[model samples]
Target: MCQTLRQKHNLTVRRQDVMLMMADLDPVGIEQRSRRRFVRRVYHSLGPNHVWHVDGYDKLKPYGLAISGCIDGYSRKVMWLVCGASNNDPDIIAHHYLQCASEFGVIPKLLRTDCGTENGTMAAIHCSLRSTHTDDLAGASSHMYGSSVTNQRIESWWSYFRKQNVLQKDLDECKEIWNTHTIRAVNQSRCPSGKPDAMYALPHRFNGRECGFCISQENLNEFFVELTRSTCGDGQLQAHFEELHAQSNLTTSYTWEAGVENYITLKNMAHI
Candidate 1:
């Protein structure tokens, strides 16, 4: 049916497009029911601050290393990536989150991870959340607010990234070099379309100016704080934190001790 439609309309009918067309063609009552279900599922998946998706990939190698990565949904940024010999634990995953939090001065409200042994373990998830200062604050804010998980977005990104960077069949040949180069390249590259809405507008409406590559960390923090306070509340600078806190699952004033510790450590190292 999709092939026929594509031929008739001179359109490339992808799976999702075909699904949408089918839903539209369904009986009115059925369409409504399906739409409701879809909406419910989507709403349930997004938390307020940021939703992170983590996954591990087995490298093609005699080296036998595994690579893990976490991506932020809103900014479409690669938060963290680590390569290690063992894929049996969540230490790398937790460390990745810590790195992201320190870099951005914000914590993810919900984390979406695959149902693998390393990711799905109760101990891993608990430790991942409990060990971080940002997580503690995120938990408190969530308790005073609300939060959710959306795994579909991260899964979609994974598919796209694999297709673009790692879909080669000859994984054993140039895999190590390719993996390292590709990961680094992807991180440094800017999205061709530019940032969503371009937080800063052009000086003149008609005149074309190239958008800047990055915003300073201080400015970014200020922008985020203002956005959070305006959108959520003065008390909680993160919407997801507030959402989860409202649900009584998180606290409101947890310490960011880990963040502080890392910052001090980095400063000292820089001095040396």
Candidate 2:
């Protein structure tokens, strides 16, 4: 609070004063109870893209909407956050990973995700690409799977997600806020406190390094071909989805409300 005021308004108030004012303004938030946990896990990451944590947020699943995301373990930058119809689908989740890698033109040295069946396709793709390299984190070792709760970085972030909002637009706006917001330093932690996007873009500024690996253009193309086959049902499903979209009267301009409305309409039409 103090830093934000100083940076934006050129005000120099003590931290305590700012805290008190904020407390009065948001008493419920200030008095919010902390969740009790058994352990405080201390983790280490070599740098941005050293490890990418991927997970599914299911709070909206009951509404026929799904959210999937990936975060940088080192800088806590949200690599991607997407809302879709079925996060449990292997191809859908894999598409998220592939899309992110293509956009950034790089993949993490290692990927971490829970051992859910939905991650099977993503794991295969990561290993297949990493196999081209001869690094220690290549091949089948490119991804790790374990319990979802143990994927602490993204797990904790989901709690904040629950408190804030629940839509694709909300998720996108929240992701922007998260990337630009300053993080507070914690004791015994090597990760520096700073805006996530800045830390990721300039790792050296925070005594960190980049561990991203470049993707070969040929492999990227081939993978896209394979992904289309797996996810698009050989173009028939793609055409059918387009028909449904048109029937639902949805435009390219999307919102959570409209998406749910479309889903419900389709469900009713399908007699499901």
**TM-scores, in order shown?**
0.36, 0.78
Model 2 over residues 1-272: C-alpha lDDT tens digits?
A: 56547654578888889988988898877766333234576788888999999999987777756889999988999999987667888988888888899988899999999999999988999999999888898999999998998998889788867865667777887787788778888753578889999989999999999999988666776666344442333366556666777776655536656656766776676566
Once superposed on the true structure, which residue ranges of model 1 sit more than 4 Å away at CA? 1-48, 59-65, 120-150, 164-272
**Per-residue lDDT of 1-272 in model 1, one digit per residue for the tens?**
34445543467768678767767787685657545443333222222234556666664223333556665443344555555444545544554444455575554555566556565432333333434344333432321111213354445445544532332222221232222221211222232222212211321231223321222345333222211112212343344434544654333222334434543554454453
Which pairs of residues have clashing backbones in candidate 2?
A: none
Number of backbone-clashing residue pairs for each candidate, in the order shown: 23, 0
lDDT of 1 at 248: 47
The clash number for model 1 is 23
**After best superposition, candidate 1 residue 222: deviation in angstroms?**
26
Say which candidate scores most in TM-score.
Answer: 2
State candidate 2's TM-score: 0.78
